[model samples]
Every structure is written in structure tokens, then in C-alpha cells.
Target: MELKNKDNNSNSGNKQINAMTEGNPVRLILVFAFPMLVGNVFQQLYNMVDSIVVGNYVGKIALAAVGTGFPLIFMMASLFIGLGIGATILIAQYVGAGDIENVKKTCQTIYTAMILGAIPISILGLFLCEPILNLINTPADTLPMAKQYMMIIFAGLLGAIGYNMNTGILQGFGDSKSSLLFLVIATGINIALDLLFVVVFGWGVAGVAIATIIAQAFSWIFGLVYMRKKYEVLNFQILKFYFNRDIFVKILKLGLPTGIQQMLFSIGIMSIQSLVNSYGSDFIAGFNAANKIDMFAFMPIQSFSNAVTTYTGQNIGAGRMDRVHSGTVAAVTMSVIVCLLALVIIPLGPPLLGLFNSDSAVIESGMIYLKNVMPLYVLLAIVFVINAVVRGAGESVVPMIGAIVTLWLGRIPSAYYIAYNFGKEYMFYSYGIGWFFWLMITGPYYLSGKWKTKSQKLIRQ
Candidate 1:
């Protein structure tokens, strides 16, 4: 049963939610994405701090240990993240349509689902921690620490899930700034705790993990208070839980494919991680450090992509196909421009890698990875922007199919073959290859106008 809204304010009266259904597409997308971009950067910074503190203080092995667990953690959390994506789209649509009640229901539904879903995922992750590490061929020296780190992360899975779901809800409402503020709080707390725990207390990998979860839990709690006070529509009692079956089903239908895509993508990365692990802990740490550097290059485009998702969702919900197209162009252009700007990172790779770890071999390995990947970021930008536009229009299955084709056919197999036959240095080229294939899929789909029709159906349904 759908719950009744006791509040009398209509969607427009709820000033907290921005209506992207109007305004200039470029300006709106830029405005919307900036906070999200900063937030992503902060999130990545804390992640880098994790690597830096561990690599510098604990050892290269600890860096590799944390790195090894990341793909596995993401794989486990992917489903809920997907559901959050679904809820964001639903809420965006409802907000656009002035269906404030459904918007509230979506926020409530996804929150409840995330809280409930975290339990089994936590248990499963705990049980599989060691076994999964073994399966991934984690370096024996790193495995125990990796297992410990992962177990702590899993045990506090609700914090991460809840925090992300909270961000998704805010993003849906076109309120990206609040999410950024939350991330700022988390990042500050996390960095301080990381130094205090690992550097001061000598807790090693365990300290970093504990600091991370505490920060996330704190951020999630702060978001709740912030949202409740700032937005009446978002004010809901956490203790009183309910699920609107129809909204959940809608979320599941949209989110399941994206979840599967995330799982497959994570699995592909895990396979690549195993191959890197075969080279031992130094290479793993280098790869991890390089990945962090790469995210800085990638984050702007990614932020624009996310911005367009909400942009396209809200515009399409308002029956503005033209705005969707214009937004896509604006987002794509902005992303490519940022990608070009980010190419500056390639020349600075060695120093960047050195910041994470002082070892020469680690720096060399990271530079090799960076040189191979950074130049081709324009392709990734195009792929991500177009893909987000498709997803925003509620055509998630196509993007999922793109992931399957790209990963199975383009990235993973190519990575293994190139690494084994040519050399490990060539493995990063597979990222560009996969991204090219993704663009091939999503670009054509976007041009076909099929996604707009699908969006209409989704909105109507």
C-alpha cells in the first residue's frame, strides 16, 4: 500500500528540490555537476589518503592489501548502489512531474531497502572474505591484512550503503550541494582519523578500516539531520519503516541490470587485479596508486555524466526531449573539455605516484599504467556521457548490455592476452578498448531516439 503524505506542500513549494525541467541546459548541467565533482574529488582524496597512509606508514603490502579488497567490496555493494540509482531516477521523474508523494515514497522505499539489504550482504561478505582473497590470487603476505580490512568494511556495510543512498536521494532532488557538504564532513573526519589511528596509534590496516566506517556512519547520520531540517519532503522517521511494493519493483526492474553490470565490471577488474597480484605486492600497490591518479582524471567526466543523468531524467519526465538532447551535447562537450584538461596529469604521473609511495619500482609501475591510459580519456569521456544519457532516460538494459560486450569481449580478454603475450605494460590499453566498444553501443542507441520513447513509457508507468 502507498503511504499518504501528511504534509500539504506541493512539489514547487518544496524549495529544496531544484527543477531542472527549466533553465539553460549547459548552465544547469555545469551548475549541478560542480558540487558533485568536488564531492567525488573529496571522496577520491580520502581513498588516496587511505593508500598513501598505508603505503607510507604500514608498508607496500598494506597498500596492496587495501587495494585487493576494493573490487570485492564494490562487487558486494553494487546491487544496492544500483537500487539507489534506480530510486534516484524515480525520484527525479516524480519531482519533474510534480508527483511529490511518489518522490517521498521513493526516498523512503530505497532507504528501507538499503537498511534491510545490508544485513545479508554483510554476512555473506564476512563469510567469503578469505575465500575470495584466495580465489583472486592475493599475495600471501597481503591476504590476512586484506581479509581483516575487508571484514571490518563488510561489518559496517550499512554505513556505506546508507551514506550512498542518502546522496542518491539528494541527487534525485537536484540537491547536489548537500551531498558535497556531507562528503566534506566525511573526508575531513576520515583524514584526521586515518592519521590518528594509523600514524599515531599504529593500528595499521585495521585502523584505516575503522576510521573509514566511522566517517561514513557519521556522514550518514549528519545527512539525515541535514535533510530533515532543510527539506520537509525528505523528513521521515528512520525507525518507522515501510516499503511501497510498486516503487520497489520499479526500482528493482531499473536497477537490476545496472547491478549486474556493476558486478560484471567488478569481476572483470578483480580478474585484472589477480593478474597484477601475480606480479607481487609492489606491482599491486603501483596499480592501486595509478588507479587513484586515474580517478582524478576521470572524476570530472564522471561528475558530468551523473549530472546529465539527473538532467535527462528530469527533462524527459517533463516531456522535454529537446532539452535532453541539448543537455547531452552540453554534458558531452563539458566532459571532453575536462578530459583534455586532465591530460596534464600524464606528464606529472611520476611525482603523483611518488606521493603515495617512495619506492622507485612502485613509481615506475604506476607511471607505465598512467602513460598508457591518460591519453585515451577522451574516449572514456564520450562513452560515460552518452551512457549516462541513456541510463537517465530509463534505458538501463542497453548500458548493461554494453558492459557485458565491452568487458567480456573487449576489456578482460584483451587485458589477459595483451599482458601475457605482449607485456603487462600493455594491459591498460584494454581500458581504452572497452570504452571504445561502449561508445559504439551507447552512441548508436542514443541516436536512434529509442531511449526517449522508453523514457515516456517509464514516466507513464
Candidate 2:
């Protein structure tokens, strides 16, 4: 009866939860993806709200300070998220196999592992933030505020890390709705706090960081309560929790590449950011505004990528390769539609950049970035959609290689060499060149049907 009530709350009367492993390919992917899309948008908006408030009120310096620290923050943050994705893939497979006990064990293990890991990470982040900022040649004007912002965010690392891991666990079981609900609640709270701390309290950059931390804490806490209430299989017993060496080993093997890929990706961006920093604050501010806008363009593909990940994870776990194939086709179609829709914002780019910061130079620079990158989003869309299938098959290393190689080998080298000799505008084109080669390298692997063999063998494990 309790489980029945939970089902009713989530699925409602006529509408049932979209089960990825057992439905029409296109419809299932869309239904499963909608809530995630909304959640991601809200997440991005919450980030945007920080810039909007800070840029409009605290000034561009504050905005620049916040923007400067983010890539560094995300570098570490993505490590945990990638680790969760590893857990998600394994859990999805276990759930698909109807191994309820193992699913519970996996959940407990991930929870325990992350909790143990967060403390050291948080401390290290706080200690490292300043040194790294200095290394990036962060301007003296912004350094103090940037350190303040980055440290506070680190102090609350548990909330951010835990929340993402919970989202991953839920997604693994095809429960996107709950994570969306939690995100909605958190984002609403975040927006309200943004106004209170930044405007009402005059806390500036620190205020936004505080708001984000509290909001993340709310989501993680609420996620725990919900899981305990709804899932008998999700109950966390301290005494029952022991190191599952086998599960931990599996999670690391499949997921470490993802974590490495993201860390290296962020490192590559940091490398570029170090160069961007040398140009001065106006350029940094403009890069931030353009990146904020770029998130809107990229978020859809990310949403679809996540949907495909969950879809492929669940279906492959259920031994439904046919569903995986059809779903990939549908995901690619959805991705193209989203990429086209994002283009509408391109012509509106100048005004949007201006909204973030009214400086003429900042506006013009940001517009250049949007115009160059946004049009080529379709190429990016193709790589993301196809990679989703590859990752869901637990062939994470393959895509990870494709990503790191493209960034370090292609994007980084080209960006630096071009900027050093010719100019920066040409450097932006390297973004496309990188994606094109990435697609060329990875797209064929997907078509070759190698991942299908890997997925088939995974079931036997």
C-alpha cells in the first residue's frame, strides 16, 4: 500500500512513469527527458541569477570574480559527478536485472564512499583555491572576492557532491521526476536567497555563494528523506554498510575515465582561462557572459545526453539492444531540434550579453563568442548524443579518450598557437575544429557496433 501510494504520487492517474526499457523509443526518451531538461534549465538559471544580480547590482568586477572561480570549482565538482555517473551506470544495470538487494547495497556503498571522501576534498579545495587563482593570474582587483566566493563554495562541498550523487542514483533507476522536483525546490530557494543575500544583506559575491550552498544542502537533505520514505530498498543502515570491494572496483574501472575526462576537460579550460586572464577583466567578464549564454545553448544537448545515458543504461541492462538502437536515433533527432532552437538566441546575442554587463567592449566580445560557437552546436549535438550511447554501454573509456584527445591535442594547441601568432577570433574557431574531429573519431565507433558487444557481455557479469 505504501509503495502503491508512492507510485500514485509520481505517476498520477492516467499517466504512468515512463519506463525506458519498456516503451516506444521516441516517446519514452522524450517523456523521460522533459523533467531533466526543466531541471537543468532551472539549474542554469540559478547560476544566471547570480550573474544577473551581481552584474546589475554589485558590479562587473564581482561578476568577473564569480566567473573566474567557476571553472576551477567545476574541475573538482565534475570529479564527484563523474563518479556518481559511474555508480549510476552500474546501479541501472543491477536494477534492470531485478537484483533489488544488490541495488540497495550499491546505493549504501556509494553514499558511504562519498561521505568519507567529501571531507578531504573540501579541505583541499579551501587550501588550494588561492594558489590556483594566483597561478591562473587572476587580477588583483578580483582575487580577494574570488577567493571568498570559492572558499565558501568549498565549505559546502558535501551538499553539492551529495545532491548530484543522489540524482545519479535516482536516474539510474529511471526516476528523473524526483530529482527534478528536488531541483525545482532548490532553485526556487536559491533565487529567493540570491535576492536576500545580495540585495537585502549587501553580501555581494559571498551572498550568492552562500545562497547556492544552502540551496544545495536543501536538495541533498530532502533527497535523503524522500528516499527513506519511498524506498524500502533505499534505507541506509550504518551497521550493514561494509566495503563492497567488488562493487567499488567495478565503479572505479568504468567511471574513473569519465572523472578523468571531466577533470582534464576543466584543466584544458583552465589552461585557456589562464590565457584569457592575461587579457584583463573586461575580456574575462565578456567570456563569462558568453559562457552563461552558451549554457542555454548547450544545456539541451546535456539534457538529451543524460536522457540517452539513462535510457541506454536501463535498456541495455534489460538486454534490449534493439531499444538502445532506436533510442539513439530518436535522441539524435531531438538533439538536432534543440540545436536549431538554440540558434534563435544567437541573433539576439548582443542584447543578451549587454543584459549581463552593459560595457560596450564586453558586449561585442561576448557576441563574437556566441556567433562563432552557437552555429556549430549541431556538430556538438551529434557528438554528445552518440557519446551518450557509448557511455551507457559502460564503454566510458572510449569516449573519454575521444574527449581528452580532442581538447589537448586539437583545441588547446590550436587555440594557443593561433592566439600567439594570428589573433583571438581565430582561436574561437578551434572549438568547431575540435568538435568536428571528435565526431569523426567517435561517430564511427558508434556505427561500428562495438559497444553492443560490450553491453552484451556486461550482462553476464
**Winning candidate number (lDDT):** 1
- Show the colliding residue pairs in model 2: none
Which residues of candidate 2, in runs, are more than 4 Å off? Answer: 1-18, 237-241
TM-score of each candidate structure, all chains considered together: 0.97, 0.94
lDDT of every predicted structure (CA atoms): 0.88, 0.83
TM-score, structure 2 vs. true: 0.94
Per-residue CA lDDT of model 2 for 1-461, tens digit only, reads 01122123322221222357787888877877888888988988988999988988888888789999887888877768778998888877765655555666778888888888888889988999999999998999989999999999999999989889989888887778888888999999999999999999999999999999999999999988886666666767633556687787777766888989999998899888887788788888888889998888788788888888988977787788878888898989889998898898878888898888898878877876787788888999999999888988889888998999889988888888988897776567778878987898899999999877778565455
Worst window of 10 by summed lDDT in candidate 2: 1-10
Model 2: lDDT equals: 0.83
Q: What's the lDDT of the predicted structure labeled candidate 1?
A: 0.88
